[model samples]
Target: MNTILIIANLLVLFTFIIHTFGGDKNLKAIEPEQDSPKRLRIFWTMSRGAFHIVSIDFLFATIGLALINFTDYFQESKLLLNLLALYFLGYGIAFLLTLIISKKFSNIYFKMWQWLLMLVIAGLIYWGNS
Candidate 1:
């Protein structure tokens, strides 16, 4: 059994839970008012859709990791594991680049700590595949 992969799977599962439930309040806050312009409303709708799509992605990743760790189904699929790792690494890089471009260094770590979790998860996945 790949212990590192198992841990990564657990983390991904936890991330999915938090992102789905814990982010609800924040998501609601961004909702456009009924009286808002059509473009604003449309943007909000698209944003919300994108947000939920990420949650779904995380859910799928969690399931994928679980299958890889607990079953022989994906045991030999190193390329799949690498793809997952790259996906997460890209997410982390996106967050980091956003933070850098924002020029808000006051609270560097707390500003976008999600990047750290993403990078760690990516590293664990890659390491486990090896």
Candidate 2:
């Protein structure tokens, strides 16, 4: 289980790094060029900030998980473990709620993908507790 977590965290960290650098292209592709220069600039700036924040947040999460798995630090903290599980559960619930209530995204496949991801997170939490 530790090995699985280490590998998953590493992969997520790598993906976050990639998005931090490459996300601008995807954002630009989605945004229209005909928009006003001011609006475009503001959008791009906000997008870049969001990307950076996401990358840093993932980096911290990855490091925290790695430490919990591989080091003596926080290894025996039951409270921390419970908090992590709660975080996972809360995130899963958020995904499910969003998928259920949001009609803005009509893609069933995407909804299914989110549901599966939520299940995986819940499973990981359960495994950790067990």
Candidate 3:
């Protein structure tokens, strides 16, 4: 469990760094069309990848919290955990589809909404683990 928490934190931190710093120069260079098919696909793929990576942390955090909240209700938490896990699975699918087909959602760390969500999820992860 400790290992899982640490891994989650690392992933979140790494993602934050990349999302924050990785594309600044590029963003300035590219005058992306907001609604173009190519741009939209790139946006989706990027957003999806970021989402699932953060979801890993959320998944672990929720599991950790569920464990702490109700030790005897492990079975119940298992269902919740399984559901969260499935979201991550679906995230991967959507992410990959965007990468392969749409090419817009790829590496999506642009929108302020997504960045804020990542931060919120990180906080949730910390609370869940703690």
Candidate 4:
């Protein structure tokens, strides 16, 4: 078994759990007031959808990585593995770029540190495949 991929799978699963349950409260906190403008309400609805969309992505990644590590189902699917690696790499890069562009460099490593996890998972997937 690829131990590194297994670790990556576990991390993805953990992230899914946290991003789902733990994030729900934060999601609720963003709800627009009933008296808010129509555009604000619509934006809130779209934002909520986008938040759950990410949860779904994490769920799928967890299942995909689990299958790849625990079974022979994807033994011949190098392209799939590479694609997953690239997906996480893009996630990490986008996250870092957002932080940079936002000019939030003070204590950047600890604040909104999900990018670190993303990069670590990407690295593990690539290294395991290699």
Candidate 5:
């Protein structure tokens, strides 16, 4: 269970690193047409803001999971681990509710991946406590 959590955290860390470093390039690939400069600026700001939130959250999760697994290496904070789990569960539920209400997604693949991630976090938190 610990190993699983470690692996999950590593994957999330990798994802955050990719998004934080390659945000511009990745966003460029999916850039949508805008009618005016103002619209484009708004779109970019929203996109980057979203990316920043996800990246920062994942960064915290990665660190928290790492500390949970290797308590001696870093200051282990049960509160942090619990908070991370709650964050995962909340985001997962939010995603599910959003899909249920709208039946639409900016990226279906990412949504599915998030579900898997939520499950892993849930598993880790449940088993870690037991």
Candidate 6:
């Protein structure tokens, strides 16, 4: 589990580094329907939306350290690891909720992709841990 967490954190960091550097975003595909300002706004929103996942992922990865450190802090600490699991579950819920309720990001392809990917990630993590 310690190794799992270290790897997960590393993966999150890698993802953030990739996005922060503007790597491989499919920006050319989305088109504005009518108003140029609206188009610009959507483009901006989509562009920024990609970074939020990295931020959240990095945060969770930081928390994953508790799985390692907590055992030393308190002997026989399985609950700390359990909290990490709940963190993932809660994060997933938050992502799903944002996906459903964020009207500002509506009609944006990036948000849709973010929402779907988060849910999928949540499921995979849950299943993998279970």
Per-candidate count of clashing residue pairs (backbone under 3 Å): 0, 0, 16, 0, 0, 0
- Candidate 2 has an lDDT of 0.62
For residues 11-78, what per-residue lDDT tens digits would candidate 1 score against the true structure?
99999999888876687888889999999999988887888899999999999998787777874679
**lDDT of each residue in 1-130, candidate 6, tens digit only:** 4445545445445545554454435433354445668768777668667656656655555555444533465453456445555665575677667767766655664645544544444444444344
On a 0 to 100 scale, what is the lDDT of residue 99 in model 3?
47
Model 5 lDDT per residue over 11-125, tens place = 6687678757787577777676665577787888798788788888878778777777777655545566666667777877776666667666677647556666665666666
TM-score of each: 0.90, 0.64, 0.38, 0.91, 0.69, 0.42
Residue-wise C-alpha lDDT for candidate 3, range 1-130, written one tens digit per residue: 4544445445545554555456444454553566768866687668656645664555455555445344655655545544444444554455445445644553554432343444444444444444
Q: Flag clash pairs in model 4.
A: none
Error of 1 at 85 (Å): 1.0
Give lDDT tens digits, candidate 2, residues 55-111: 676577667667776787885645655565566566567667767786665676474
Alpha-carbon local distance difference test for all models: 0.90, 0.62, 0.50, 0.89, 0.69, 0.53
By TM-score, the best candidate is 4
Runs of candidate 1 exceeding 4 Å displacement: 103-105
Q: What global local distance difference test value does model 3 have?
A: 0.50
> Which model scores highest in lDDT?
1
Q: For model 5, state the Cα shift of residue 45 in Å.
A: 1.9
Where is the poorest 10-residue window by lDDT in model 6?
22-31
